[model samples]
Target chain A: MRVLGVDPGLTRCGVGVVEGVAGRPLTMLGVGVVRTPADADIGHRLVAIERGLEEWLDTHRPELVAVERVFSQHNVRTVMGTAQASAVAMLCAARRGIPVALHTPSEVKAAVTGSGRADKAQVGAMVTRLLRLAAPPRPADAADALALAICHIWRAPAQNRLQRAVAAQHAQNAPKGRTA
Target chain B: MRVLGVDPGLTRCGVGVVEGVAGRPLTMLGVGVVRTPADADIGHRLVAIERGLEEWLDTHRPELVAVERVFSQHNVRTVMGTAQASAVAMLCAARRGIPVALHTPSEVKAAVTGSGRADKAQVGAMVTRLLRLAAPPRPADAADALALAICHIWRAPAQNRLQRAVAAQHAQNAPKGRTA
Candidate 1:
C-alpha cells in the first residue's frame, strides 16, 4: 500500500509518501515540507497548509494517510498551531475518501527504531536504513514524517485484523440486528 | 455587519448568526447545533463538521465568521478535538474569503455580561436580553456562540482602528519604495 504521512505544523509541515506492503522493501514516492509565513494570519496559514496538502494528495495519490496524533504541550500556542495543521491534513484525506490513521510519537519511534524512547537521530537513522537511502532525510520533521508512514504501514494490518475479530465476536453475541 | 459565531466541539458544535453594528440591536438570524456520534471514526467526524460549517456559511453568507479560540485544557483528548473543530471553522471562513475572528471565552463573557468570570447562566441571560428574546437559548454552547458574535461585533471596530493607526504610522516612517 502507498501511504502518505504528515508531520503537521503551522510554519513547516512535513509530508512524505511511501509505497510498500508487509515483508516488502518500501519505496520513497516523495518527501517535502509545506511552509507558511509565521507573520501571516492564522486563517491564511491554515488555508496555505490546506492548499499544499491538496497539491500533494493530487500528485502522489497515496492509498492511506497517516497523521501524527497531537498531544498536550507546555506551549499552548505551539500545540494549538500543530493541532490546527493536523486537522487540515485529516480533512484533506477525508475529502478524498482516503483512510487516515493517527499514530502517537512514541508509537512511531517504537515502530521504526525498536524503542518507544528513541530520539530523533535514532529514528532518522533507522528510516534511512529501512528505505535504503544514502543519507537521512534533512529537517527532522521530514524524517519524522517518513517514520510515521512506516509505522502505520507495519501496524495497520495487525490492527485491522484485531478489529475485525472483535467485530465478529460482537456480532455473534448480539441479538437480532441490535448490538448489546 | 453580519457575523456567524461557532463554538467548536467534537460531539456538539454550536453555530449562530447575528446581524448588527456595534451600537445597534442584534438580530438572531439562526442558531443550532451540529452533533456527531461518539463512536464514529475521527476522519468521518471531522468531515461531518466541515460539511455542517460549510452549509452554515453558504446559507448565512455572513460578512464575518467568529470562532471560539480553543485554550489548553487539562484533558488532552478534549483539547485536541476542540482545536481540530476550531480549525475546521476557520478553514471554512477562509475558503469563502469571509474575514474570520477568534474570541477567547473570557472575552465573550466579559463583553456580554460585564465580567470575564461570569458563569454560563449569566452569559445566557445577557444573550437573551441583548437579542430581545423571551427566553435564553437552549444548550449553553448555543448561547456561548451568540455571545462570541456579540463580542466580535463590539470589539472589532476598535481593533480595526488600532490596526489602521499602526499601519499609518509605519507607512510614514518607511522608505519611499518599501514598508517598515
Candidate 2:
C-alpha cells in the first residue's frame, strides 16, 4: 500500500511518500516541505498550501494520506495554524477520493523508534536506517512525515477495522435524504 | 458591498450574508447553518463545509467573505475543530478570488453594540436593528455570523487601509522568483 504522510504546519508542511505494506520493506518515494509566506494573510497562506499540496498529490498519487492529528494542548499560537494546515491536507486527499488517516505524534514516534518519547535525533536515525537512506531527511518535519507513513503502514489492519465501524455507524445515524 | 459571514464550527457552521455600507441601512440577504454529522470523519466534514459555503457563494455572489478569527485559548477540544472549519471557509473564498476578512468575537460585538463584551442576545438584537429584520436570527451562531458581516461593513474603511499596508509589506519582503 502506498501512503502519503503529512506533518502539517502553516510555515513548513512536510510531505513524504512511502510504498509498502506491513511486515515488508518500505520504499521511500519522496520527501519535501511545502512552505508558505509567514507574512501573508491566512486566506492567502491557505491558498498557497492548497496549491503546493496539489502539486505533491499530482506527483505522488498515493492511495492513502496520513496526517498528524493536531491536539489543542500544543503551543496555543501555533496549534491553530497546525489545525488549519491539516484541514487543507485532509481536504485535498478527500476531494480526490483518497482515504485519509490521522496518527498522533507519539504513535509515529513509537512505531519507528520503539518509544513514544523518542527524541528527534533518534527518530531521524531510525527512519534513515529503516528506509536505507544515506542520511536522515533534512528538517525534523520531513522525518516526522516519514514516521507517520510508517506508523500507518504497520497499523493499517487494526485501524481499517475501526474506521469501517465508525463509517457504518455514521451512515446508520445519518438523517434521511440529507446530503453531507 | 455584500459580505458573506461565516461563524465556523464542526457541527453547526453559521453563515449569513449582509449587503450595504457602513452609514447606510443594511440588508439581510440570508442567514442559515451548514451542519455536518458529528460522527463524520474530519476530511468528509471539511468537504461538506466547502460544498455548503460554495452554494452560498454561488447564490449570493458576495463581494467579500468575513469569517470569525479562531483562537486556541477557547475550549481546547472545540478550538481545533473551529480552526479547521474556518480554514475551509477561507479556502472557498480565496479559491474564487474573493477577498476574505477575519473578525474577532470582541470586534464583532463592539462594532454592533457599544461594548466588546456584549452578550449574544445583545449582539443579536443590534443585528436585527441594523438589518431591520422582524426578529433576531435564531441560533446564536447565526446571529454571530450576521454580526461578523455587520462588523466588516462598519470597519472596512479602516481595515482596508491596514490590509493594504500589510499586503505591501509582504510583497516587498517576498523572496525573488519564489512562489508561495
Candidate 3:
C-alpha cells in the first residue's frame, strides 16, 4: 500500500508519501513542501496550495491520502486558512477519485510516538526511526507529515479495502446536499 | 492618507485599509479576507497573492503598505515558504514604488493595544474599537493587518516629512536586489 500525508498551512504545507506491504517495512516514496506568500492575498495562497497538491498528486499517484483533520479555531483567519487548505487537499484527491483519510494531530502523534502530546522533535525522531530514514526530516512539519503517513501505513488497511470502507461510512453519514 | 495592511497566507489572507489620520481616528477604507484552495500549487497561489495585492493597491491607492515580518524558523521548509511569501508582498509594493513598512507580530500587537502580549481576539477587539467599527474583524489576521497599518500611520512622521523621507531613503533602499 502507498500512502500520502500532508501537514496543511497557509504559507508552508508539508507533504510525504510512503509505500509498503502489510506486515512489512514501509519504503519512502517522496516528500516536499508547498509554499505561498504569507503577505499575499488569501486567494493567491489558495491557488498555490491547490497547485502544490496537484503537482504532488500527479507525480505520485498514491493510492491513499492521509491528511490532518481540521478542528475548531479560535483564530477565524487561521481556521479559515486551515479549512481552505484541507479543501484543496480533498479536491486533489477527489479529482482522481483517490481515497483520502484524516487523522487528528493527537492520533497521528500517539500512533507514531506512543504519546499524543509528543513535541515536534520527538515526533521527528520517531518518524525517522519508523521510516528508517538515514536522517530525520529536515523541518518539523515535514517530519510530522511523514509520521502521519507512517501512522496510517502501520494502521490503514490494504488499498481498495480500506478506502472503500471509509468511503461507505462517510457517504452514509454525510449531510444531504451540503458542500464538502 | 489611507493605508492598506496585508497579512498574507496560502489559504486565507488578511487585508485591511485605513483612511483618514492617525489621532483623528481613521476610516476603515475596507476590510476582507481572501480565500485560497489548500491543495493548490504554491506557485499559483503566489501569483494570486500578487494579482490580488496589485488590484487592491490600484483600487485603493493607499499611501503606504505594512506587512508582517517573519522570524527565524528551525524548519527550513516553513522559513523558506514564509520568506517567499513576504518577498511577494515587498515586491508588490516596490513595483508600485509605494513605501512599505514591516512589523513583527509582537510589535503589531503592542502597537495596536498597550501590550505586545495581546492575543488575536484582544487585538481584534482593539482594532475594531480603534476604528469604532460595527463588529470586530471576523478574521483576526485581517484586523491585525489593519492594526499594523494603523500602527505604521501612528508612527510615521507628518505627510510633508514622510514624502521627503521617502525621497531620500529611496536612493539607498531602492527595490533592486530586495529579495534576500
Candidate 4:
C-alpha cells in the first residue's frame, strides 16, 4: 500500500510518501515541506496550504493519507495552527476520495523507535535505518512525516486483523440468513 | 456592504448574512446552521462544512465574510474543532476572493450590546432588536452568527479610518517622489 504522511503546520507543513506493505521493505517516493509566509493572512495561508497539498496529492496519488493527530495539551498557539493545517490536509484528501488516517505523535515514534518516549533524534535515526537512506531527512518535521508513513504501513496488518476478528464475532452472534 | 458571518463549530456551524452600512439599519438576508452529525469522521465533517459554506457563499456572494476568531483558552477539544471549522470557512471565502474578517467573541458581544462580557441572551436580545425581528433567531449559535455580521458592519468604518490614517502617516514619512 502507498501512503502519504503529513506533519501539519501553518509555516512548514511536512509531507512524505512511502510505498510498501507490512513485513516487507518500503520505498520513499517523495519528501518535502510546504512553507507559507508567516505574515500572510490566515485565509491566504490556508489557501496556500491547500494548493500545496493538492499538488502533492496529484503527483503521488497515495491510496491513504496519514496525518499526525493534533492534541490540545501542547502550546496553545501552536496547537491551534497545527489543528487548522491538519484540517486543510484532511479536507484535500477526503475531497478527492482518498482515505485519511490519523496517528498520534507518540504512536509514530513508538512504531519506528520501539518506544513512545523516544526523542526526535532517535526517531530520525530509525527512520533513516528503516528506509536505508544515507542520511535522515532534514528539518525534524520532514523526518517525522516519514516516520508517520512507516507507522501507518506497519500497523495496517494488525489493525486489519483486529477488524476482521470483530466482524467474525458479530457474524457469529447473528442468526443465520439475516443478510438482507 | 453584504457580510456573511460564520460561527464555526463541528456539529452546528452557524451562518448569517447581513447587508447595509454602519449607520443604516441592516437587513438580515439569511440565518441558519450548517450541521454535521457528531458521529461523522473529522474529515467528512470538514468536507460537509466546506460544502455548506460554499453554498452560502454561492447564494449570497457576500463582499466580505466575518468569522469568529478562535482562541485556545477555551475548552481544548472544542477550541480545536472550532479552529478547524473556522479554517474551512476562511478558506471558502478566500478562495472566492471575498475579504475575510475575524471578530473575537468579546468584540462581537461589545458591538451588539454595551459590554464585552454580555451573556448569550443579552447578545441574542440585541441582535433581535437590531434586525427588527419579532423574535430572536432560534439557536444561540444563529444569533451569535448574526451578531458577528453586525459587528463587522459596525466596525468597518472605524477600521477604514484607522487604515487611512496609517496610510497617510506612511505617505508623509516616505521619501517624496520615489515613485519612479
Candidate 5:
C-alpha cells in the first residue's frame, strides 16, 4: 500500500509518500515541504496549507495518509499551530475518503529505529538505510514524515488485527436480542 | 452587517448569528449547537463539524464570522480539540470569502458586560438584555456564541479605523519608486 505521511506544522508542513507493504521493500514516491510565511494571517496560512495538501493528495494518490499525532508542548503557540495543521491533514483525507492514521513521535521513532529514545541522527540514518537513499532527507521534518509513513505501514496490520479482535469480543459478549 | 459567532468545541460546537450595525440594536438570526458523539472517529467528527459549519454559513449567509480565539488550557486534550474546531470554523469562513474575526473569551465578556472577569451568568444576562430577549439562551456555550457576535459588532468599527490608519501610514512611508 502507498501512504502519504504528514509532519504537520504551520510555517513548514512536511509531506512524503511511501509505497510499500509489510515484509516488503518500500519506495519513496515524493517528498517536499509546504512553507507558509510566518507573517501571513492564520486563516490564509491554513488555506495555503489546505491547498498544498490537496495538491499532494491529488498527485500522489496514496491509499492512506499518516499524520503525526500532536502532543502537548511547553510552547502553546507552537502546539496550537501543529494541532491546526494536523487537523487540516485529517480533513483533507476525510474529504477524499482516504483512511488516515496518527502515529506518536515515540511510536514512529521506535518503528523506524527500534528505539523510542532514538536521537534525530539515528532516526535519519535508519530512514536512509530503510529507503535505500544515498543520504537522509533534509530539514528533519521531511525525514520525520517518511518515518511516520514507515511506522504506519509496519504497524497498521497489527493494529487492524487488534481492532477486529476487540470487535469480535464485543459481539460475543452482547445480549442476543440487542439490535446494535 | 450580519455576523456568525462560533464557540468551537469538539463535542458540542455552539453557533449563533446576529445582525446589526455598530451603535444599533442587534437582531438574533439564529442560535444552536452542533454536537458530535464522543465515541466517533476523529476524522468523522471533524467532517461532521465542517458540514455543520457549512450549513450554518449557507443558511445564515453572515458577512463575517467571529470565532472564540482558542487559548492554552490546563487540559491539553480539551485545548487541542478546541483549536481544531476553531480552525474548522475559520476554514468555513475563508472558503466563502467571509471576513473572519477572533475574540478572546475575556474580550467577549468585557465587550458585553464591561468586565473581562465577568462570570458566565453576567455575560448571558447582558446578551439577553442587549438582544431584548425574554430570557437568556440555554447552554452557556450558546450564550457565549451570541456574546462573541456582539463583541465583533461593537469592536469592528474601531478595528477597521485602526487598520486603515496603519495602511495609510505604510503607504505614505513607501519608497517613491515602489507601486502598491
Candidate 6:
C-alpha cells in the first residue's frame, strides 16, 4: 500500500509519502512541509494549507493516508485547531477514495521507539535509524508524522477488519438484537 | 485595508473577501465556502479546505483577514478541528503580508446585529439584509463569515490604525490617560 503520513497543523503540516509492497521493501516516495505565515487570517491560512496539500497530492498520489489521532488536553483553543486540522486531512483522503488510518501519539511512539512513552526526540531518533537516512527528519513534527505511518503499518490487520466490526456489533447489540 | 473573513469548520469553512475604501462602500469582493467530508481524517479534510481556499485566494487576494476567535464548551473533538482550521487560515493570509484581525464571537455578533446575544439565525438574517443581496446567503455558515468581515469593518475606526494602537497601549499602561 502506498501510504501518506501527515502531521496536521494549521501553520505547518508535515507530509510524508511512503510506498510498500505486500512482502517487499517499503520505499520513501517523498517528504516535505506545508508552511503558512503567522499573521495570515483564518481563511487565507486554510487556503494556503489546501494549496500546499494539493501540490503534494498531485505529485505523490498516495493510495492511503495515516494521520495522528489527537487526544490532547492542552485547552479548548488548542484542541479545537488540532481537531479541525485532523478533519481537513481526513476530508482530503476521503474525497479521493483513499483509505485513512489514525494513530495515537503513544502508538506512534511505541512503533518507532519500542516504548509507548517515548518523547519526540526519541521517536525521531528511532525513525531516522529505522529509515536509515542520511539525516534525521527535521522539524520534529515531520519525523513524528513518518513514525505515525510506521505505526499504522504495524497495526493494520490484513483481512479481519470486517470480522472485528461484526463481532463488536454483535457484542454491543446482543441483548437488543434478541429483543428486536 | 482589505480583509478576508473565515468561519473555519470541517464540513464547511466560510470565506468572505471584503475591500475597505476610505469613504466608499465596503466592497464585497467575493464569498465562497470550502467543504470537506465529515467522515474523513482530519489531515485529508484540511487538504480539501486548503484546496477550496487556494482557489479563492488566487482569484481575489485580500490584504487583511478577520477571523472569529473560537470559543466552545463540550465536544472537544469538534473544537479541536475548528481551532486547527482557523490557524491554517491565519497562516495563509499572513504569508501574503496580510495583517490578521481576530474578533471574539460576541464582538462580531454585537457588531453585526447590535446584540451580543444574537443567535446564528438572527445574525444570518442581519447579514443577508446588510449585504443587500437578492436572497439570503445560503449555507448560514457563509453568511456568518461575511458577518465577520462586516464586524471588522465596523469595529476598525477610519483613523490611522498605527496611531490608535499606540494610544490604546498608552491607555492600558497609563491609567491617567483615561478620561474618567
Report lDDT per candidate.
Answer: 0.84, 0.86, 0.70, 0.85, 0.83, 0.68
Rank by DockQ (best first): 2, 1, 4, 5, 6, 3
lDDT of 4 by residue, B132-177 (tens): 9999998999999999999999988767455345434533653321
> Can you list each candidate's DockQ?
0.33, 0.45, 0.04, 0.28, 0.26, 0.16
TM-score of 5: 0.88
Fraction of the native A-B contacts that model 4 recovers: 0.56
Instruction: Write the residue-wise lDDT of candidate 1 on A6-71 in tens digits.
Output: 999999999999888868998888889999999977876788888889889889988778999988
Candidate 3 yields a Cα-based lDDT of 0.70
Best by DockQ: 2
Residue B50: error of model 3 in Å? 23
Error of 5 at B46 (Å): 0.7
Query: Cα RMSD (Å) between model 5 and the true structure?
Result: 7.8
Give interface RMSD for all predictions: 10.4, 5.1, 12.9, 11.5, 10.0, 16.1
**Candidate 3 per-residue C-alpha lDDT over A107-134 given as tens digits, one digit per residue, 9 for 90 to 100:** 9999889999988888988878878899
Candidate 6, residue B21: Cα displacement in angstroms equals 6.0
**Given candidate 1, what's the lDDT at residue A48?**
83
Candidate 1 Cα errors over 4 Å, as ranges? A160-180, B160-180
lDDT string, candidate 2, A85-169, tens digits? 9999998876665678999999999999999999999999999999999999999999999989989999886775565565455
- Candidate 2, CAPRI quality class derived from DockQ: acceptable
Summarize candidate 5's per-residue lDDT along A1-180 as a digit string, tens digits.
788999999999999999988899999998889998999667667777888898998899887789999988668899989999999888777655566788999999999989999999998899899999999998888999999999999999767455445434533653211010
lDDT of 1: 0.84
Candidate 4 lDDT tens digits, A72-174: 8879889888999999998887665566789999999889998999999999899899998999998889999999999999988666355345434533653
TM-score of predicted structure 1, chain A: 0.87
Candidate 3, B75: how far from true, in Å? 33
The deviation in Å at residue A123 for candidate 1 is 1.4
- The count of residue-pair clashes in candidate 3 stands at 23
Scored by Cα lDDT, where does model 5 land?
Answer: 0.83
Number of the top candidate by lDDT? 2
Q: Which is the leading candidate under TM-score?
A: 2
Question: Regarding TM-score, does 2 or 5 come out ahead?
Answer: 2
